[model samples]
Target chain A: MPYGYVNSMKTRPGHRDEVAAILTGGADGLRAAGCRLYVVGLDAADDVTIWVSEVWESKDHHDASLRLPETRAAITRAMPLLTGEFSSRETIIAGGLGVTAG
Target chain B: MPYGYVNSMKTRPGHRDEVAAILTGGADGLRAAGCRLYVVGLDAADDVTIWVSEVWESKDHHDASLRLPETRAAITRAMPLLTGEFSSRETIIAGGLGVTAG
Candidate 1:
């Protein structure tokens, strides 16, 4: 099974757009880092919340991506704008339309 | 843009599989109701969490589905097993793979 994670982050008041940019900018980079799917979306109900839905080859691939310099830098940049409240649910994707079983 | 929603529902101790079944069984029903894509995944970090990521033709289509007899029936069947606690984030999907913009 592929590793999937739904990460929800709350951005400080007007910083949601900034945080979104950081995530979107890193999207292509993530694809190069063993990511099968990476989606960055702005929550409609609340302007402060950002959602990142990811599908990776493995949990190790996800962890390794975070350790990369660019990934680390992006997180650092978005941290200051974040409110620190988040709902992260990591999952072992069983099967899905775009996901390939492992 | 397609309307997208990420819903994280919690199942009581051993009911995750049961809830998953209901979600999967309703997958076809959802498509019949204008669901462009529906993915059900079980949380890895926690066995009780079920993540449903959806892409709809419109938010109205989603709301309408809930009103459908079959969809309502499935929801009722899964209710008893659900913990009633969930994280639902609705978004305006700005262009992602496999989604057709409206």
Candidate 2:
């Protein structure tokens, strides 16, 4: 079906390189508003615990790429390196379970 | 604060009932294993896509819960009702964005 969005943010310990440089400057505006997959992972023994896996081609192009504006300034510069309370949810892939392709 | 896990599974067009049943069955096992929050939601427009939000005391707790037979069986039962694909990821809550209480 091709609709996906998994966003998990939890970064604090040492900032994780300023939240991966604000998620690589919004990752080309979320791949030019279509966003195939923009990933940022860090949690090898903590690092504040940040995880984002996004693949969008539906749900209205992931809600119009979160209203662009470079995805709201890369979430306002990652909201001050976060310490413990970021959450996100949106998903619709509906097939089975197969995600071992690194 | 606390660690959490978000699991998203997309179901078939007309299998929401069956899917929900399986989830309900496994709810206790999860809760008994120390799960704090376990909520399942279905999209308004699409009935196939499913999303699950889980809050655990810690990563270790979450991992251990999966080892429970009840948890595994629930997943296996829902496998057939799915249509597109299913994926999940875990994260730590680093204070920043706050979810509106429901």
Candidate 3:
């Protein structure tokens, strides 16, 4: 089954965009690292929250991704702008439209 | 800009699979209704929660889908299996991998 992760983070005031940019900047590397989907989103109803939704080939792939140079760098850049208040969930991609475990 | 919605719902004990089935059953129709992506995910660490991630061409398209016959029927079938516990976020698709507003 494809591993999924959905998370929301609160950025420091006025830093939401910066965090989002940093997150998306690493998308290219992620695709080659077994990521099937990697989305950076800005909360429509709030200015300080950013959401990231991801689907990976497996849990191991997701864990390995965090150690990649680009991924590590992106996390470093985004961390400073974040408030540390976050919520996340790890999921198993059962089945759905526009995506397949393959 | 594309509209994004990520939500989690708790299913009554032992009803997670049933609820997930109901949610994904309408996937075929969602694509025709302007849904770019619709994912039904089962919590990896929990058995009773299901997460749904979606990207729509526009908020209007998403709203209109709620009125579709299949959608309504699916919701009705799934409601009885849910526990009424939910968490959701509405977002703007800033940028990402494997997805585009168009």
> Which candidate number has the best TM-score?
3
lDDT per residue (tens digit) for residues B67-96 in model 3 = 998889888888989989998889999878
Clashes of each: 1, 15, 0
* CAPRI category for model 1: acceptable
Q: Give lDDT: candidate 1, residue B69.
A: 94
lDDT of 1 by residue, B3-102 (tens): 8889888899988888877777766677778887676779887789888777788889989988999988988899999889987879876543334345
Any runs in candidate 2 off by more than 4 Å, and if so which? A1-102, B95-102
Docking class of 2: incorrect
Q: What DockQ does each candidate score versus the true complex, computed on alpha carbons?
A: 0.40, 0.08, 0.79
The residue-by-residue lDDT of candidate 1 on A1-102, one tens digit each, is 778888888999999878877776766677788887766667898789877777888999999998999988988898999989997778877554445456
Per model, kept true contacts as a fraction are 0.35, 0.02, 0.78
Q: Rank the candidates by TM-score, best first.
A: 3, 1, 2
TM-score of each: 0.81, 0.49, 0.96
Candidates in order have lDDT scores of 0.78, 0.60, 0.88
Docking class of 3: medium
TM-score of 2: 0.49
Two-way lDDT contest, 1 vs 3, winner: 3
